[model samples]
Each structure stands twice: as structure tokens, then as C-alpha cells.
Target: VGVCVIPIRYIGRKMLARARVVQSSQGDLSSTLQENFSSQRDIRAFELEQQQIRLFRDRIRRYIQASIGAVRWQSLLTPLIEFVSAIAMAATLLVGNMNGMNMGDFAALATAMYLCYEPVKKLGAVHNKAETLNAGLERINHVLNAPDDVPEPENPRSPAAWKGEVEFRNVCFGYQQDSPVMRNIDLRIPSGQVVALVGPSGAGKTTFINLLCRFYDVLSGSVKVDGIDVREMSKKELLSHIALVSQYPVLFRGSVADNIRIGRPDASDAEVEEAGRMSAVDSFINETGEGYSRMIGEMGEGLSGGQRQRVSLARAFLKNAPILVLDEATASLDMKSEEQIQKEIERLASGRTTFIIAHRFSTIRMADRILVLEKGRVVADGTHEELMASSPLYRELYNKQQMVAEEEGGAPC
Candidate 1:
């Protein structure tokens, strides 16, 4: 009995290892399928259907090959165990024949051995199932054991009537400590001022806002709101006072009204419409097949870029928080759409401490103050006109955008 179980256990362990690889391949295949389905518009626009099909087919083949590897090991186990049992049965029969045992005794012993064989086979099959399940469970356990990047403090404090004053005091941060993204950033922004952060792509403009929102805490100095370090406040309580409109707004499968109400779930329908109207979304919502109740496809795929930005703006307006941050809110809009959305953004930012991350000369000109970052450090800080006169980099960036605007047959910002 012990000898028979040995080979079965050995095969089970080997199958378990292979099962993990099969599971990994399946995960990759599933994620790719979902991404392709969600971005079908982009795929069609780029005319990459043949390329996408080829990639998907290759992914499926790899998954099949991995599954077959695990299955091969599983198939070998039962046959091997049965062969071992046959050898044992033959030995027992020969011994019984040499001792001249009675026919009845031999028959009884043979019947018992045959019956045990069925249970042994079933046990081997159960081991195969256990191996597969254990591989899955191991993945789940790994995720469960992972720690958060910014964990909540054991004792947290909520702000008392925060007046929306934001300050970055000698702050420095990086996703990787060795490769710093923002360095020695010190700024004092008064309440209700609109500040624009402008720089080249790697200047850490996005990371700056991300740190302000406590998405990632600073490595050295501190970010403060109303003179209180953000780290000292509860994340939820801290973020409740601020509203952000990101470069790529996220919208799930839901009605337009539902998506807007995500900012404040308990807000009344009238409030949602009021926000939509304020953000220039109400005009277009009426044109949709279902109006405010229109069902959005995954990632809001059915909506145009401007339409999606309007929805995102409506959500931000709905929040009506004291602080607003726009990460290139109008970057992808058309000239007319950009002008309209810019108007809506002004309304949303009114009376709120606002931050803008932009490259458009038109957008940066509206900022009360502009901070020019270079290689993760602030190189210049002043109004647009002041920077144009004093900072060569800022002047060059403005000139580039002005040329682009002129080439597009648009007025210089």
C-alpha cells in the first residue's frame, strides 16, 4: 500500500508545478482578450485586426501547450500506478500457487486486492484535482499577503474646517528611491488660487499632483493642507476635500447619471443634471439614445473623447469640493470643444484652490501662477507673462505652442 502511494504522490507534485504555469498562461490570455475587447474602437481605427488575431491565436496556442503539459503528467500517473499494482497482484498469486492454497482462499484474496485497486485509482484522481486547486489557492494567498504602499495610520486625525491652503515644503518623492521624480519642491499656494505646473514629459508634473493627493507619500519633506501634514490626516478625510479630473478619466459600465453621481452617490437627480449642465455635458446627453440614462460601454468606449471629458468634469463639479486638480483636462479636445470645456473648468475651479497640469499656451495663461519644472526640480515660478520674460525654457515652450496654434489656424493664446 505504501509503495503504491509513493509514485502517485510524486506525480501529483510534478503536476502541481506544471498546473501553476498553465494557470499563469491562462491569466495572460484572459487579460489580453479583455483588453482587446474593451479597446475594439482603437483596434478598428488602426486596422490591426489581422495583427490582433494573430497575437490572440498565438496566446491561445501557448495556453493550450501549457495545459497539455500538465495534462500529460496527469495521464501518466494512473497508468503507472495500475502497472505497479499489477506487479504486486502477480507476486501474491504466485506465492498462493506455490503454497498450494485452496481455490476459495485465493479467490477471496484476489477479489479483495481488485476492490482495493478501484479506491487507489480514485485516490490518485483526487490528488490530481487537489494539485490544480492548490496552484490556484497559492496565487490567491500571495495577493492576500501583499502589503499596501501607503498604509493607513493606526491613529488618524481628521481636519477641522480646512481652508484649502496647499503647500509643498521641500518635498521629494520617487516610485523608486534611486530614481527620484520630484526634488526639493517648495511652494506656498494660497486658498482659491489656480496654479499651473508645466514641464516636459519626465518633469514629474503628474507625480507632483499624485503626491499632493496622497496617492504616494513624499520621501523627504511634507505636503500640507491648512498647515497640517497630509500624512497626519486620514486618507479618506484628506481626499474628501479635493476633486481631481485626471488625464484619462475612468468610467465603468453604467448610465451617464450614475457615472456623475459617483462623485457623490447620495446627490439628488436634480443636482446631477445641474452639474451636467454646468460642465457642458447636459447638451450632449440629450442627443444620446437614452439621454441621462444612456448605458456607457466598458471604459466609456461609446463616447467621444470630449464627451468623456465632459462627463468627468460633471463628476468633478458634482463633488463641489474646496480643491480641484485638472491633469490636462482639455488636452485631447478639439478647438471648439476645448474652448467650451475650458469655460466649464473655470466655473468648476471658481472659489476652489485649483491646480492645472497643461502644455497648451492657452490653458497655462489662465493660471494665477505657473511653476516650471525641469528634471524633477522647479526651475522657475511666476505668472505666464513674468516667466516668458524671465525664464528661457518657459519662453521657448510658449513659443512652440504659439506656433502650433498658428499652424492650426488658431489665434495665439
Candidate 2:
């Protein structure tokens, strides 16, 4: 019995190491497949089919090699234990003969030894299974034990009322500690004001909204909503008061009604339809003959970009939050679609604190206040007419956009 355990222990260690490698390689293969599947359109558009195929094949080869290594160690364990057991049985027989034991006594002793060896053999298999389970747990724990970059407050506060008033007081922040993306940002926005953020690419436009949503804590100073520090409020509670319509809206595999109902889960069917109608989703949806019941594919497949944006807009309308954020919300729409949705957006923005981030002058013109940002700082803040006169950067951006629109035979600002 003791001799049999020696081979099991040695092979068990080798199996454990190989099992870890097998799990890691399997994860890599899965990640590659998921990414390739999700970006199929881009792959075909850029003529990257062969390159992607080669990459996937390489990962598959590595996964197969790792799996074979683990199997080899596992297969070796049982056979080696069986051989050790045979040697032990032979020794027992020789000892019994030397001590002059009768055939019946030797037979009984051999049966008892065989019974003990059977359990030991099963233990080796159980050990191998245990190692495989441990490897999977290690991977799961890596994600489960990861640190939360933004943590919830222990004792959260709720305001008496939500007024949608936002203020940034000497706020400074950066993705990295040493380099600041936003510096000394001090601004006060009254409730129910329509504010627009204009900037060149990488000018911290998205980051500015990210901070207002409390996606990340500021490096210094504070951001306040209705005279309450955002850090003191529960993230869930704070987010409940705001609705965001992003540039690239994500839709799930469900009916149109289901996606819109995500904004307010308790919303009734009639309410969902009303919101959809307001956002112009009803126009095309009714043409399908299924209306709100029409099923959507993953990531809004089978739907045009404009249709997807309207669906996202419906969600925001259904939410009816006091604060509204439109991050290039109409970017995917055609001129007519943009004009139509722009009207609904204006109606929705009434009596709500609204923030718009857009490059189109037509959209920027709707804002009561336009903030021109450059390198994370607000270089200009005023109405569109005010910025055109005061801010060179804002003027240059508008002029360039005007030229591009003219070249494309679209309406000029």
C-alpha cells in the first residue's frame, strides 16, 4: 500500500501543474474566439479574414498542446499505480511462502490486501479531479478578489429632494495620478439649464460626463449634486436621478419593449409604447407588423444604426430622470432623422438639467450655454454666438465642420 502511494504522489504533482496550464490556455482561446466573433463586420470590412484565421488557429494549437499534456500526466497515474500494486502482491506471496503459511491463510491475506489497494487506486483518481477543480477556482478567484476602483460609501445619504443642480468646485482628476485630464474645473450649473460640451477629440469631453456620473472619484476637490457631495450618496441612488444616451447604444437580445423597459423596470406596457412613439421608434417598428413585440438580435443586429439610437432614446424617455445626458446621441441618424429626434429631445429637456456633447453646430446651437474644452480645461463658456466671437478654438472647429458639411453637400451651420 505504501509503495503504491509513491507513484501517485509523484504523478499527482505533475498533473496539478499541467492542469493549471490547460485552464489558462483554454481561457485564452475562448477570449480570442469571443473577440473575433463580435468584430466580424470590422474584420470583413478591413479584409482581415486571413489574419484573424491565422491568429485563431495559433491559439487553438496552444490549447490542444496544453490539454494533451494534462491528459498524458493523468493517464500515466493509474497505470503506474497498478504496476506498483502488482509488485506489492508479489512480495506478499514470497513472504507468506518463506514463513511457511498454508495456502488458505495466504489466500485470505491476499484478498484483504487487494481490497485495501482498490481504495488507494480510487484516491489517486480523486486527487487528479481535485487538482483540476483547484485550477478553475484559482481563475475564478482572480476576478472575484479583484479590487474595486470605485467603492460604495458605508453610510450613504439621500437628499430631501433631487433638484438636478450640478457644481464642480476646483475639481482635478486624471486616469493616471501624475497626469491630470481635468484641472481646477470650477463651474455651477443651475437646475433645468441646457448645457453643451464642445471639444476636439481626446479633449476630456467623455471624462467630464464620467465624473458627473461618479464613475470615478475626483483626484481632489469635490463634485456636488443638489448641495450634496456625490461621494456621500449611494451610487445606485445617484444614478437613479440621471439618464444617459451614449454615442454607441448597446441593445440586448429581446423584444423592443423589453429593451426600453430596462430604464424603468416597473414601467407599464402603455408607458413603454408612449416613450417609443416619442423617440420615433414607432415609425419603423410599426412597418415591421410586430411593432414593439418584434425581437431584436444581440447588439441590436438586424437594426440600422438610427433605429438603435432611437431605441436608446426611448429608454431615456422612459426613465424620465431629472438629469439628462446626450453624448453624441444623434450622431448615427440621417439629416431628417436627426431633425426629427432633435425636436423630441428638446421637448424632453424641458424643466430638466440637460447636458449635450456634440460636434455638429446644429446640435450645439440648442444649448443655452456652450462650454468649449481644450486639453481638459474649459477655454470658452457661453452661447454659440458668444463662443464664435470669443473662442478661436471653437470658431476653428465650427468652420472646419461647416467646410466638411458643404463638401458632403449637407446643410451648413
Candidate 3:
């Protein structure tokens, strides 16, 4: 039984790995198909994948338990081994009585046999269960006790006001160990200035923004807002002074009014509607016949990408913060929607520090200054005309964006 238990433990672990892989693969397939299908088709594919994974997991669990059950039966066989020894003892007694031999010798032989097998069998069963449970407990603790890579400061101060000055002092950072994403970066953004961050993918545009928001800390330097190190400020206090609009804006399941209200929860219905009007959202909201009361399903499911972006812009307008960060906020909008949203953003950017991360050269041509990042370092910093005149890399990116805009049947940038 002790030897058999070793094999059972190995088999159980193999089954557990197989089950985990099967479940994970099914989930991956569902997510991949979801990216390409309509809502109805996505739902059907997800349901089918879910069913297959559930059946596969149940079968694996049942098979592993059945293997355990067989080991348990093998363990119970030790009792039967004892019963056999007893019968042998009884035969010895009968023979002893018939031949006038000792009965005490037979009883002693039976007791010794039981003691040899019983403890080993019970110990095997106990060890088998303990090993299986230990594997499960190890996985649970790993997720629960993992430390945060970015932690809040122990004694943090709330920022009373942000003068909207952002500074990066010799910042160095990387997602991986040794390969720096951004290195030796120094930047100064004054209050009420619109600055554009333009670079190719992996050129550290997003990483720069992450550093500003303190999503990830710098390795060897610091980011300061209004002359105060961002790390010294509480997360909530730092965030309240900034409004961010992402390329993919996440809208909850609620009415259009409710979505705008997220920016300022205490805002009245009339204020929400005013934001919509400012973003030209009122036209679409009224046209859809739902007015402001129209529902936006999970993640703004029923709205077009442009529409969702407009709503997000409206939320930013409603927030009315001293600083705004736009991460390709207008990348999805049509010319008309872009024009409307750009107008609102420009209006909002007045007297506020705005960081615009844009791939479209046409959008950022009006930025007060553009910071060109390459391999996580600021290689060029100037106005559009100045960068085009001085930096070859900036010129290349500007020319590429102009070509793209021309291909889209628009005037060249």
C-alpha cells in the first residue's frame, strides 16, 4: 500500500495539470473568437466553450477520485489480510488442540501479523490525502499573499492644489529587469500648456504616461506635480486633480446620463445634459430617441466606437479638472465627431495642463509643444515646425502620419 500511494500522487498531479490546461485553452479560444464576432455569435461561441471546459473538468476530477478510491480499497485489503491471518491462527489452534500443542503461540502469531500491516496501510492513506491537499493549498496562498510591485507610501499627504506643472527628473524605468523602457528623461510641462507625446509603438509613450500617474514607480528618479514628488501624494488626492481619456474608454451598464455622472457623481441631471450638448452628444442622444435616458449596455455595447469616445469626452468635460490626459482619445472619431470633440477638448485645455498622446499629426499640430520619445528617452522637444526642421525622427513620424491621413481621403497633415 505504501509503494502504491506514491504512484497515485503522481497520477493525481498529472490529472490536475491536464484539467487546468484544458480549462484555460477553452477560455482563450472563447476570447479570441469574441474579438471577431457579432454579439450573438460571440455569446453562442462562449457558451459552447464553457460547456466543453465544464465537462472536461468534471471528468478529470471523477477519474482522479476513482484512482484514490482504488487506493482506499487496497488499504482496506490490510483488514482482509488480518482476517486471513486469524483464520490461519484458528487452523493452528485446531491443530494444536488435536496434537496437544500450545494455543497461546497461535494467538501471538495473529496479533503480530495485524500490527505489522495495519499501521503501514493507515499511514499510506493519510499521507496520500495530505500530499493532494498540500498541492491545492500552495496555489491558493500564492495568489492571496503576493506583494504589490507598486505600493502606496506609508505616510502620504493630500495635495491641496495642483499648479498643473509636471516635471520628470532624470527618470529611468523598465517593465523588465535591465532593459530600460525610458532612460534619463527630463521634461518640464508648465501650467495651461497643451503638450503632445508622439512616438511609435514600444517607444515608451504609454510608459511615460504611466509614470506620470504613478501606475508604476520610477526606478532611479522622480515625477513631480506642482513641484511635489508624486510618490509623496496620496493616490486619491493625486488622481482627483487629473482626468484621463483613454483610446478604449470603459463605460458601465447605465443610462447616458448615468455614465456622464461618473465624472462628478453629485452633478445634477441638467449639468449632465449640458456636458452632452458641449460634446455634441445631445444630437445623437436625441436622435436615438432615448434622450439622456438611453441605456448603455455593458462597456457601451450598443454604441459605436465614436459614440463611446464622445461620451468619454463628455465625462471629462463634466469632471472639469485642472489637468487632462488624452491617450489617443480622438483616434476613433470621424472628421465631424473629431471636430466637435476637439473643440470641447481645446476649450477645456485652456488654462489647464493637458497631455495629449496622439498618432494623428493633424490633431497635435496645434499643441504648444511636442515631446518626441524614442526608446524611452525624450529625443526631441519643440513646436511642430521646430521638430520638423531639426529632428529627423520627428520628421519621419510626421511624414508617415500625413501619408496615413491622405490615404484616408483627408487633406495632408
Best by lDDT: 2
Candidate ordering by lDDT (highest first): 2, 1, 3
Q: TM-score for every candidate vs. truth?
A: 0.91, 0.94, 0.72
Per-residue lDDT of 116 in model 1: 90
* Root mean square deviation (Cα) for candidate 3: 6.6
Query: Whose TM-score is greatest here?
Result: 2
TM-score of 1: 0.91
For candidate 3, give the lDDT.
Answer: 0.78
Clashing residue pairs in candidate 3 are: none
By summed lDDT, which 10 consecutive residues of candidate 2 come out lowest?
404-413
**Candidate 3 C-alpha lDDT tens digits along 281-365:** 8878898798999999987988988889888888888888888999988888887677667777788888999999988877786
Off by over 4 Å in 1: 40-50, 341-344, 406-412
TM-score of candidate 2 on Cα atoms, chains taken together: 0.94
**Relative to the unseen true structure, what is the C-alpha lDDT of residue 204 in candidate 2, on a scale of 0 to 100?**
90
Task: Give candidate 3 misplaced runs (Cα > 4 Å).
Answer: 1-141
